[model samples]
Target: MDVAEENSEEALLIKQHRKEKKEVQAKIQCMKNSVPKNDKKRRKQMTEDIAKLEAEVEARHKEKLEALAQKPTEPTQVSSITNGVTSLDLGSEEPVQQPRVSKAQKRREKKAAQEKERDDRIAEAEIANLSGARHLESQKLAQILAERELQIRQIPSDGHCMYRAIEHQLNEQGNSLTVANLRSQTADYMQKRAEDFLPFLTNSSTGDMYTQEEFQKYCTDIVNTPAWGGQLEIYATCVWTGGALQFCGTTGHKYREQLVLPDINCHLEDGDL
Candidate 1:
């Protein structure tokens, strides 16, 4: 179908025609050599006939060549009959492309990568330092608390309807005090625990800022007092608003589902006043 390939076919046909013409010439020469000298006139007449036949052959050859030349050559790039290389001039389907990744773009990418790595390293270092400090501080704090006669205690938190065991301590006399978890315990309950530290606080500000840990210590003192003996005698308990508390001791209902109210702080009762 391609013009170039068709032209090549035409060239081959021309070559084949030329070879046929040569073979015909060789046959005529053989016939002439076979005749005798005495038969000159006959030979001449025969030669004229031979010339006419050659002319007829030549005319036929030329007609065939002209027919081939007149045949329209397809402009298609590929030939269905032949698998041959063909020359061509055709438009490219692809657009001209600019080189990828400009110098400035590369620089930006590299800088961004470096910045990300730097930030990650800094974050990791800060976290490591904080963890180390917390470890040492926790160790020291544990030692200080152990100085008091501490025991584990639990408080019922309905949030976890199934009771949980928490940490705490009973004093020498047998009365116990617990730290509270503010998130789970009621706001009023947190306030009461806050007030428990008040008697030991040197100033109103200290009481206002009383920590769960601080109140816990003072409770231990009050429980151990000779006046209280094995029973805790909390004068009153008051409830206020905010903050967190850690619960202490193993918790379970006094009798599976029954409440266990022990005599302790009465601060909340005073609030009715």
Candidate 2:
């Protein structure tokens, strides 16, 4: 068999196992979350059930891998006995010539290889996403949210995440204001207190403090464009809204979602949201 055909079944099996494992993990998580902490007996039974499920799945996966590894290749006949003489079959024949592959066939093979490679990468990424480190962080965050009676309100990671999160908080607290309104207010406040903020604002290109023109342009960008907000904007926002803002993360330390935007696309400087 050709390499692609030989490995196709193995790849399919791997994909199937990965999907099954993920589903089983989700089910286990749901079981844990749905059960009350006070129900010790029920929780114990659930844990046992989860252990059994994990063992069964792991055993099945290991068996499959072993089976694939031990699979015997097609056997080739070396000699044939006719009557009393043994005739050795050497590769002497012009080995039935393989049919010439068409350009279309080559293209199809290339496409198939590319697709398989993409699928393999996707599977690897899925596994990486479920690494113990990330899973632990997720569990810790969930526990904290439950303990504090707080739920995460996912903010869009558009360069305006900070503003959107603040806007959400304000709306929840009975303030009716839009992101644009908040942006305008923040810009106006910062402009009024230019002496306070301008010292902190630095030319991103050069490491020097922003000049009067640069500071004015920065405020204009914040008011008109989707520029990312930082400490300066946060200060202005707090002053205008008269509300306290709290940032939380799995780690006690503050964290910001990583952003990747072109310099020309948005004036986004690294900052916590």
Candidate 3:
């Protein structure tokens, strides 16, 4: 189909998908209100229905993406001379040969093509990841995320998601904070209380305990650079803030929420978080 026709069809599909999603959501809410709180079997069945609807919605979204990806890229058009011969034709003589592309130009073109292919691969992988997550009941997990929107601020993924997330939470509560300052403070706290963190510290990459010197270096990196923070740094930030930090964990199927109270539980790591 032509571009305009394809776009029109895609828009209609998207609108239908949204309408169905809203209807399904309304049904779910109605079911929740009518069903008894202790009716486990009925509730389980309702959950199954919701899951199926969500999966169908996700499938439609994937179909749209695949269709767009497969659409042929249009070639650029150029105007040609009407009389097919003028500039290249000599008056009753042979025409000059066209110039060949140089090796450098060919290399540049190859590099551009490779870069485009790499980007396409990345886009495909991201779509596949989203598709895989759909089967995990991401609709439920998305609800938890929506609930936390009031309290949690999203952090940019500039190699500082952890530190920036913490900083945003603190700043929201009337405290002026920067990720750099938070990182420095956390590193200092960890360094001062090395004895406490040493037992729990291990190099995730090597599966070995971090030596004192190595640990110190790691702390220094956290302080001076934009190294990604982890559970240990989060605990340090909690200590610095003098309050428990509430974290919501979602597994697509279920949520395992936690309150990280200061000094009570120094170690907590949930991949879902």
Candidate 4:
């Protein structure tokens, strides 16, 4: 066939393939909609339909590849005789060229697709929480989350968010303290006033009071390691700065604020020590 005829046939085949694929997809979607979520038998049948549709799609893709392979690569040449003189003509041959895609590019595309899928799954899980919660509590929690979204500045949860947050606040006020420096200063203050905090330092895991040696080791870990800072570090920062710290927390229905002080007589919670 001529190049034009061949191209027209390929186009028709592609259009037919697309039409068939769409019909298969529509059938699969209809089957999915007809089956109730809890209907095991109907769900099984829907699964089979999905498998069939996938196979059909794959087959149509293979047909497209076959059509491309069958396409002519050589240009047609016409010869003519004029004034009783014969002329010879050679057909032009043009090689079919396909764009080359690097493995690195493919890998990057795959990674982006996987990351998008992961984010989608996380969003779906978060939405599922609303459906699973008690109605009143769900509505309350939703409202709290909306408010928190507006007011809260999220920091990285890399075991250093608390220290980083404090560092950022200080920097905003024209102070120059790194997270590491803040942690060290807090630990030093706690160590110097161990006598005050030791009485409140109880190990929740073991249900035993912290000995002086054990408390010292805990302080060392907080300063030297990238462990997450909690109430202990908060109070230590308060004492180290010679100021009281105010903490705001919410539990869906209520917002609570507490003033953490340097005084030993202040209320000492498990984490506060």
In candidate 2, how many Å is residue 137 off?
3.6
lDDT string for model 4 (1-273, tens) is 566644554445544655655566556656665555554666898898788767766665666645554565333211111110121111111222334657787676556655555566756766776576444554664566577673446575456888888887788788898998888888998888787677777888987889888998989998887688877778878767666666665555675668877674454545544
Candidate 1: TM-score?
0.24
Per-residue CA lDDT of model 2 for 183-247, tens digit only, reads: 99899977877776766778889989999999989999998887899877876787667666665
Model 3, residue pairs in steric clash: none
For candidate 1, lDDT tens digit of each residue in 75-98?
432242122112110121122333
In model 3, what is the error at residue 228, expressed in angstroms?
1.9
Instruction: Show where candidate 2 strays beyond 4 Å.
Output: 1-139, 252-273
Instruction: State the displacement of the C-alpha of residue 14, model 1, in Å, after optimal TM-score superposition.
Output: 1.0
Best by TM-score: 3
- RMSD for each of the candidates: 36.9, 19.0, 22.6, 14.8
Task: Please rank every candidate by lDDT, starting with the best.
Answer: 2, 4, 3, 1
Of 1 and 3, the candidate ahead on TM-score is: 3
Model 4 CA deviation exceeding 4 Å by range: 1-150, 204-206, 262-273
Off by over 4 Å in 1: 1-7, 74-273
lDDT of each: 0.43, 0.66, 0.64, 0.64
Per-model TM values vs. the true structure: 0.24, 0.44, 0.47, 0.44
Lowest-lDDT window of 10 residues in candidate 1?
Answer: 84-93
Q: Note the residue pairs that clash in candidate 2.
A: none
